[model samples]
Target: MSTPHDRHLLVVGAGLAGLRAVEGARAAGWAGRITIVGDEPHAPYDRPPLSKAVLAADEPPPVPALRSEEVLETLQVRHLPGVRAEALDTERRMVTTTSGELGYDALIIATGSAATTVPELSGVRGVHVLRRYDDALAVREAMARSREVVIVGAGFIGSEIASAARARGIGVTIVEASERPLERAVGPAAAVRLMQLHADAGVRLLTATTVSGVRSTDVGVDKVELSTGETLAADAVVLGIGARPATAWLRDSGVELDARSGGVLCDSRLATSAPGVWAAGDIACVDGVRSEHWTAAGEQGRVAGANAAGADAGGATEVFAAVPFAWSSWHGHRIQVVGETTAAGEEDHGDGFVLYRRRGAAVGAVGINSPGPMARLRRALTAQTNP
Candidate 1:
């Protein structure tokens, strides 16, 4: 391996994680030539806003850029937009792209993940999955014309879209296989109140419902069939069934990935099993901790990039030890959560109180709608994590 000062760094993915990785590498004293490749033609932009502000507006908000073009130019990072990485040649220290092969001394994989879609919805018009900028645009356009929108799954993405659709005077029906929304994350108690928020907004929530298949015609989807023998008439269908890590290209690259989540497995320092490679963001499972939050992605990207640079520079390495934090916006309320919200013991403080998830003697997680307490709890959690 070449010294960090003499190495060529290549970062995959043009999202927030990839952009932050370049910044983090430079901050760690890496002056080597850096190249970034992205399948999307557009530059790095904020994705969280896609399902929120952009989808809710009549005129979709302009793409929210994470970093300005001038900043990238100032950083001297070469960006190859609209390019897909076909394969990784670990032995040759080269990356095979749609254009050609490029050699690299160090590689950072932050390709992120793709929104999950069902096979039954494939080739079906008006059935959309929101992941890229274009996906949100299409969904927003559909909402503008449709009176009823059927959204599969009641997770974060699904709930957000429901809110967006309702904002545009479109009736929304959210279908979830689980008994409650965010059952895996926030538990049943808090989920009840969360579900109430949607109901209060005139959105319909169908719990314990399974989508059998989608009924579509030549132009677009007409109705969605449910396992409960109920069919919902819809002009548009949005699949919020979650996402899987984008790691198919790394299949033959010899990088270790967790079988369950299909996320790239990394050590304490976010270093992958492959010698010259590191990973972060939704694509990474660091020491068994896999988080899909936007904040977690950016932080992991910083740690991974800095550690990769430090390793090459033969300097002090940084371990990724940040506590997990994620927040969701619904009905104009900020739902903030810290640590693992799915812990065994849960305490419901009742109306207007934070739900605390506990394991043994320690508090494992905290979820609240109020920003004040959430901020204080976040500080406490940060101290606990650091201490």
Candidate 2:
């Protein structure tokens, strides 16, 4: 333990990003005290399997939490669970949480994000959003029953849930406001393929569809009113719409948050506008853009934790570089995408594999239903950075 004036590193949020940050700090030989706080009652566990593997089965994936209290104890890091940060006293270098006030030398904000929901339909029967483990459990319980399941949005989450529901022989209809299910992430060209995959899996997918309001009966969903003035009968509704960063409490904290994206701004070194303060994870919007993604979130947290520990983080020269990536499995087929995939860009590599080039370095690449290309691409990307 360091001296009293040595400045303990206070990390808010106990997700993967936060855990990774603590590890990075310890790796940098920051003998100072390190404490992490989180609002969730559970330890920091893996989230990716919550939707695909955990919810799909009767039992949730046994997530032996990473860098938890035990791991933190080994690293001589403090863990403060069941606390929610309310305000930040940047001038005094102190943070006020529900538990108490903690003065720190540096702070790492990795609050992550929350599920976007239609609160107006809260009293309704069965409207759900997939964000937390409990949300998955509730949705999974509903998925066990065979009823008309109306899924809002055809994004990865929506599609994956639909696939899971379909796997159990549940009826699923995907409602997308856009023409393509995942046009926003993978671009229209690749989204078309995903849409085809949905169709092949017996999923009812409607494009250019808008949900006016959700009205469900006591038993379940009666019908979903559409903007086009049509009603589709449904038993349950799962809203897979995008998520907004949880940063409402940070207002007036003088921390620079993106007005449009709703994410805390940070430099390449992961330092926020406030001195000795940094932000990370989905809640943070580093480099103006690129706020989402598990890998990016973890990487951001690691960099922030390292820099906050008083290391030569290379300042703004440090680049948070990671190929935009996400993987999903549907109907026994696994899909992997790496690099910059857009919803509108026209991609053609003559054989359906996309290769994103910047100054002829192949900055990004996307391949569908092909692990060979993905493995090769991952190797190339890693070699470029590792070498």
Candidate 3:
């Protein structure tokens, strides 16, 4: 970023965290020239809705973009869409892009992530992922025309896809590796109702099965191979295994990276090993926090942006693991989980989430699916006395 008299901020990615960081810079009195670079052709948009609202729509969702043109005009920033960062020349303080190398006093690596496409699925004529807006559109079109869809994961992504498919009169078969669909998230007990929801909607929930690969036949998608030596024919496949970070550009940037987790190791100040460099969002692996959470991403963006823009970014970042939470909707049921109910614990593992006492006097319940228990449970987390 340049000086206030001659403001200049070069944001690397045009995703949510990138835009927020640039806005933070501008708000901190940046004036010269603000440039945003993105790998996607489209402007910044929210990804959560792509799998739910945008994918079920009749036409490509014009649902009014999440970004405001005034934010750009007010910030006096230039946007360069469809450009990827090739490398980082920290010595020269410049970022090499597809267009050309641009110098920056400070840089934010917010290259969000990409959809993992499976080319190994032979004749998987209409397989798609739900990470990007375009991917959602493609999946929407395929689902509209498909009669049967084989979703490869029973995670939130796969379950949500099955929900959307069932809404459009398309048959959905969810193949999960564990005995329960969301055993890793809500535990087996909580996942029972989720599976029941799918069954109520006539969805074929295939548990304890894994999709080895897919083979194309004369028809659209001929068959899907299972490790169990079972073959199932499908019209389309949606692979929602999981996602990795988009931190490939920082491979040699001297910023300590955790290759296994696909994230950058940030200190308490949100600064990386490199000076004047801060990282956040899914790419940042902060201690005591999991990757890929809306709240965590927002907190990281705020913390890193403040420090990167010369503001007091507070002291050591707190281990803000309030509760490992996630919410999903299927067949009109709103299922919200507040804590990690996915561990191998007994009925009440002290650390695990469960219905328990308020504080001293009485017991306050805590269950992933029941709302009454959740209500009192949240109260207990805040209150010191009995409810």
Q: What are the root-mean-square deviations of the candidates from the true structure over C-alphas?
A: 1.9, 2.9, 4.6
**Can you give the lDDT of residue 352 in candidate 3?**
24
Q: Name the best candidate (by TM-score).
A: 1
Q: Where is model 1 more than 4 Å wrong at Cα?
A: 1-6, 357-368
lDDT of each model, Cα atoms only? 0.84, 0.77, 0.68
Error of 3 at 174 (Å): 0.7
- Candidate 1 yields a Cα-based lDDT of 0.84
- lDDT score for candidate 2 against the true structure: 0.77
Off by over 4 Å in 3: 1-3, 117-119, 122-124, 217-219, 311-325, 339-387
How close to the true structure is residue 306 of candidate 1, measured as C-alpha lDDT? 89
163-199: candidate 3 lDDT, tens digit per residue: 9999999988888887766655655555665677789
Instruction: Count clashing residue pairs per candidate.
Output: 1, 2, 8
| Candidate 3 or 1, higher lDDT | 1
Per-residue lDDT over 1-387 for candidate 1, one digit per residue giving the tens place of the 0 to 100 score: 234355799999989889889888888877899999999988888899899988887686788888888898888899999999889988899999998998998899999999988886776898999999989999988888899989999988998899888878888999998876787777666777777888888888898998898888776789899989999999999999999999999888888889999999998788999997999899999888788889888988888888878888788888877777777887776777777667666666764444565545435444546767667767777898788
The lDDT ranking, best first, is 1, 2, 3
Model 2, poorest ten-residue lDDT window?
310-319
